[model samples]
Target: MKTRSGKGNRVGLAVLGLVLLAVGGLAIARALGSFGDAAAREPVVDAGARSFAATTPWFWPVVAAVGIVIGLIGLAWLLALLRVDRPRRLRLESGTTGVTEVDAHPASEALAEQVSTYPEVRRAHAVLRGPSDDPHLDIGVSAEEPADLGALVTRLHDEAVPDLRTTLGLRRLPAMVRLNLTGGRRTRPVH
Candidate 1:
């Protein structure tokens, strides 16, 4: 859920991608060379198997165990990539009846939309995190050129925070709002 963890996952994937690409390229090159001369082609499995057969039986077990460990490590990396954070459902009180459950996505999206309406804002994203009863709003926003950072923060604190709290029927909602400036290419001045 943290930014560092997400970055680490990406780094792992990139390393794996590079390794696979190198291995595949080697295989393709070997295959193409083999096509030119059938006699030059070597038995891939037989060569490795014969070498292993000459070694002690214990060596085979050690090699197999190392392969299994590497496979498990790869599996763990894959599972981390596939992980999805499930947001908790917010419970709403009805008229002297059982509570109604609602998905937090709608409310979060609406809040994000409101934030995005600011003149300086280019894009905004919001997600409800933590416990359903006491949730945290995680917002990411990108701003246009020459945007006033102070004013933006003030507006989010004064306007957006109250709006979200009142609309969601909560006393306090902890928020993490991340702001970034949008990139724009500079034009060269001509004399």
Candidate 2:
């Protein structure tokens, strides 16, 4: 994969270099021709004017050469950006048919199930915070009501902690349930 990408970039750079060189050469050629024509007329004209026309050819070639060099430098910079490696998370796959399974499913699933039992909880998402060495979880709980923030935290702690301990065998549950009050519930009309 790396080699293929590198080769592609090289090919692109080569094409760009060729194009720039061609343009530069064309520019220089045109300038030189113009200068030559002016110089040929200079002998019939004045000495000062002849010198000025002679210097014109040198100016255009220098400008064209600088443009080509700048284009090459820009191409190199773009290639460097393309070649940089991006960081990615490692995913685990099942062996038989190569299906991907999420890491620490049991714990997260159990937590979600338990949190959903509360009447006030509208929606909940359990996410593992860290890697294996020292792991934690951030359980984001969207609530139906704004009341009882303290009570909700205590209730979740009381219910989830013991259940996680028994079912998932998590000795130290570094699980934090953050309650986000979405809005108040709609009131039903009296019949």
Candidate 3:
């Protein structure tokens, strides 16, 4: 199964990072006297504290409400992290004329096994995506040394893909195949 992109998560993380960086940099700069001398800053702190002391009683309630809203946002973010998307299932017909449902995981495993049997491939994995009735495949293969990649691609296009489509009763079996070299070179003993 394929997972949806987490663009929202990325944006949230980026904004949080920038806010932390700005606030931390400001605090460090103030502590390091980048703003001015320490003696000159004493009056500014005293004036700010005096202004805060003059606030009306309603100010505290507004601050508490803002804190609650921030807490709710945190709760929502946590929920999103925990959420899982269910995989779609493939429907098949049994010899008894009954209908059967197969999960994507098992179907993908079968496909991976079929593809891995090729002499050039060291290992293979497949993932099914989209609805079960109309699915797409993402296949990854590890090739042995001296494997002919071009011939393999041709075989997939001509034989493997058509066989998969026919077996699955699908009109088209859209697939993405990735190949990687599996390093297995043995060192020889020197004289």
Best model per TM-score: 3
lDDT of 3 by residue, 1-191 (tens): 22334777778789999999999988777777888877436554576666775676776788899999999999998887876443567765446777776777877788789888998888999887666666778889899877899998887778777776687777787999898988766789999
Candidate 2 lDDT over residue span 1-191, tens digit each: 65787798789879989999998886676556755766544444478767776778786688789999999998887887665342122134336777453446566667887787777788777765555423566788888766677777887778766675445444565777677888776789999
Candidate 1 lDDT, 1-191, residue by residue in tens: 45888988789789989999998887777777844555338654576778877776788788899999999998987897676554667755446766776888988899899999997898899898866766788899999867898999899999987797788787788999899998655689999
What order do candidates take by TM-score, descending?
3, 1, 2
Which pairs of residues collide in candidate 2? none
How accurate locally, in lDDT, is each candidate?
A: 0.82, 0.68, 0.77
Error of 2 at 43 (Å): 32
Candidate 1's C-alpha runs over 4 A off are 1-81, 86-88, 92-97, 183-191
Order of candidate numbers by lDDT, starting with the best: 1, 3, 2
The TM-score between candidate 2 and the true structure equals 0.43
Quote model 3's TM-score: 0.67
Q: Report the Cα lDDT for residue 146, model 3.
A: 79
